[model samples]
Target: MKLVSVETPEKSVCKMTFSASAEELETASNAVYERTRASYTIKGFKKGEADRAQIEADRGEHTFWYDAINDLMDKDVPALYDAALAEHGFVPVDAPVYDLVSVKKDEGFVATATVALQPELNLTKTTGFTTECVTPEVTDKEIDSVLERRRNAAAELVPHKGPAVKGNIVHIDYEGLLEGKPFQGGTAQNQTLQLGSGRMIPGFEEGILGHKAGEEFDIFVTFPARYHAKDLAGKPVIFKIKLIDVCVRQIPALNSDFAKKVANVDTLDELRAQVKQQLHDGKHASALNRAKDQILTQLADAAEGDLPSTLVESTYQLQMQQIQQQLQMQRLSLDRYLSQIHETRESFTAKVRTSAEKTARVRMALLQIAQQENLVPTEEEIDKQLAERAERTKKTLEEVKAQANVHAMRRNEGIRKAADWVIEHSTIEDK
Candidate 1:
């Protein structure tokens, strides 16, 4: 394979004309024929005894060329691409899309490929930008909140004969009617609800308050104007409610025994200390994240380059896929989530594109810095990371090493080192 011509059709876009040698094409064609000859029965020749000329005459000269070209593409294009990358010094941001230009029986094939390339960055500022990250402090209130949650989790529910109150679970049967007629999705049996939980529409749970067990009553509620159901939006409805029973949570006492039972700590003091440390660690991580974001934003702002639309779109797609996976894990639909968040598709898309562009710019700046510094992970560093990965994943070091893509690892580590360098060189002010 050979690169005949290279052209930059647009910024961050490379168009290259390349070809497979005639000899290589002929060899591939012959191999294809040899593999399928036993199945081919020419007009005058028996199976497996047909010559290339005979087969070409029987079929077409270009009959086997397509598969041969595809085989060469699979076996040879990648090596050619790598060579072009080295010789032309163009970093590809996406896979090259190839188009066959022309092909002849003995003259091999000519092809053109277009690829999106990484923008050459000239960052005006690389260091000394100030980053603000506040050191987080833990307080007794936060610790108490954690303890309260633990108590809530350990609470037991007891039947209450009195009126339903906030934090009490009420079991009831309800049938809603619009203008004295039964409506769709307006009936439920043996349903349990918590008053003041806000799980139901406005005025529904509020009416349950002060209602005693065994009482049968009706509550009127007007659906919000923005309700998802168009027919029910802003409409007043009456729900016949039958109060079965009310249950109240009996919380345990906050003591050393409680601490030991809830958290495995010997005493309340020890539990508080543990909670405080956990909170402190979380705050520290949050602070560091803020610092990283600030530093990257500043670096990206200082960079001047053309961001490939393909790269940004790819990143956006990856981000969306990750969100979809997370939503699937939570058994939620993306459209429903967007509705709950009060976001429209167009607005959300615009926001995501902005974020993706910023991310692309930041990554490009970091990669350029890494290249400029000739940054690469050391063998010891690589081994240490591999060991850590093995430990975390419960795999053997040999298995982890076998699965590791060393080149990719080196590239990613180099980019990370560049990020660390930027952070280290920056002026970080802690509040």
Candidate 2:
């Protein structure tokens, strides 16, 4: 196979014309004849024993030529395309559209393929940006919030005759009926639920509030539009609930005994100090994340280049697939999710495309920076990163290495190194 010519008549597109030798076409035609001879029975010859010439004479010359061309496309186009791509130093962003220009018997074939090329980037600026980094300080209220959670976890539930209130556990016998009929997995006896918690559907929990113990009543609720159950989604249902008991949660006082019960610390002061330090560490991590986002956003904003639509669409598709998978895990469909978001498919895709384009632009800028600064990761660095990933994923090093796309990972690490370089060189004022 040979690339006869290459042209870039359109933006981000490359068209390559290819030609093949007569010997290759003849070989392909003969192979197709041999494979399909059993299905044809020609006079004076047994089945599967007919010659290519005989079959061509019996059928039209174009009969085997079609199969031959298809076989060539299947067996040879990929390698030919790769060679053509290498000669032009272009990376395709999607599948090429192939057009057969001519196919003559024993004269080989002529074909052209057009493909979207990956955009080449020219980054104007990646460093020298000044930004404020605000590391959040642990507040007394935040520490108190953590202590309250601990208190709730250690609280005791005592039976009460009073009305159900927020933070109180209410035991009930209930049956959820859809259209006046009890549905599957919608009935429970002696079910304990906390008021104001979002464990039940929207109106169910709120309706339980203010209702006294031993009260038998019915509450109506409409399932969410994107509810996991397809049958009950967006449907109104009545829950006949008999309150069995109301258990008020009694939290212990914040003293030495409570501190010892909640944590290993012997005193309340020590526990408070520990909680403050933990909150500080968490806030510091979040601050670093915000700083990274700021740096990347600044870098992307500084970039000046047109992102390839093919790449952007591909990225959008990948993100959509991830969201779809997440929704499937929750027993919801992507269509229902879109309905809940009040968006049509086109609008949602458009929104995703915008985000994808921005992401692609940032990636391209960082990649160019990586190339300019020689920020390529070494084999040792790659191996170490893979090892760490393997440990975190609880997989063997070989398994992780086998499953990993090494080239993509290398590029990602290089981009990250470039980002780190910029962060190190830039001025970061603490605010």
Candidate 3:
């Protein structure tokens, strides 16, 4: 094998060309042919008989083998050329590099090879940008609002023999049937539903307004077109419901006793102070996230390099794999998920492409920042982060490390470090 030429540009990419001998070409061709055959299932071949059949089929099938082998050779040669370039310290296209050259073949059918080198950045002089951050102040009214919610959560329900009222709990026995056939998940016995809570289907909740306890009624309602149950979707059903009882929730006034019940606070004043602090912290975090997003948007706009198309494609594949896994966890298929979201794969892919591009730009920007600022994480820091992740995920360190590798967690960490650097140095004008 020999090297022909190499070219490296300022945009962190390398290109290389090389040649291979007839023997090496034949070897790669055979390997590719074998792999393809192993995955192929010919008719009338018994279980586990495909491999033997494939080999036998190849011996007498010169035409089949030749076509398959030639196709493999076409693909394997370029891939092998890439491998050879890397082996000789030359970077291939899509690989970051800062140098290039050409070389002549020594004594092979493969004529020549080109080589490229990975790019390196000088960490000292790049201008680092920053943003301003401020902690938010929580008001007295906000604290009181939180206290009121806590009181409502701790309220007690008192039995009443009157008509169902707003904010009251109503117990009912109901069965919904479509065309006189009960559907799955459509029947309930003695279910407690909060009146005016809007938790149930839109028309279902409002239909019970005038019904008193022990009253039986047939309420005809149409299932929303987007309802989760495929069988009931866009169908009209009649629910036979008997109202059993109505009970009102009695909430205690916001006082020292109520405050103590809700938390460890000894007085309402202390509870208000704690609630205010909590709100202040929440608002501050929200503000920081918004500021970080703005800074990242600007950085992406200012970025000056071509992103690797291969990397974006790989990221998309990973995203798809995650979606597949989540669907599996929920006992669903990709088709079901798409139906639920009212999306097709083509539309979903188009939508995700924009997000993928933004993600790729953010990643590239962070990597550039890391190189420019000498922000490489130390071995100790990596280990500590890995350990913390393992503890938080309740997995073994090795498992966490492996999963992190699969999920590009290290790359995400690098991006986070870059974000921290940007946030620490930039100026912000709050609106």
* Residue lDDT tens for model 3, 61-132: 332334433454455555566565567564322322212122112322333222223233233322344555
Clashing pairs in 2: none
Q: Write the per-residue lDDT of candidate 1 for residues 1-431, one digit (tens) a residue.
A: 77788888788877888898789888888899888888888888878798888998989988678888899887777677778777988877556778999998668899988877879888999999897889778989999998899898999878998778898998999999999998999999889898888999899999999999899999989999999999999999999999988999889999998989978999989989999999998998899889888998999999987887767887788788888899899999989889999999899888888888898889888888988887767788899999999999999999999889765687678889899999999987877
Q: Candidate 2: lDDT over CA atoms?
A: 0.83
Give me the runs in candidate 1 sitting further than 4 Å from their true place. Answer: 1-5, 16-72, 93-114, 135-145, 148-253, 261-266, 378-407
Q: Give me the displacement of residue 429 in model 3, in angstroms.
A: 13
Q: Against the unseen true structure, what C-alpha lDDT does each candidate score?
A: 0.87, 0.83, 0.67
TM-score of 2: 0.55
Worst 10 residues of 2 by lDDT: 305-314
Which residue runs of candidate 2 sit more than 4 Å off their true CA positions? 1-82, 91-118, 135-141, 156-251, 322-351, 379-403
Model 1 TM-score on a 0 to 1 scale: 0.57
Winner on TM-score (1 vs 3): 1
Count of backbone clashes for each model? 0, 0, 15
lDDT top scorer: 1
Clashing pairs in 1: none
Q: Candidate 3: TM-score?
A: 0.50
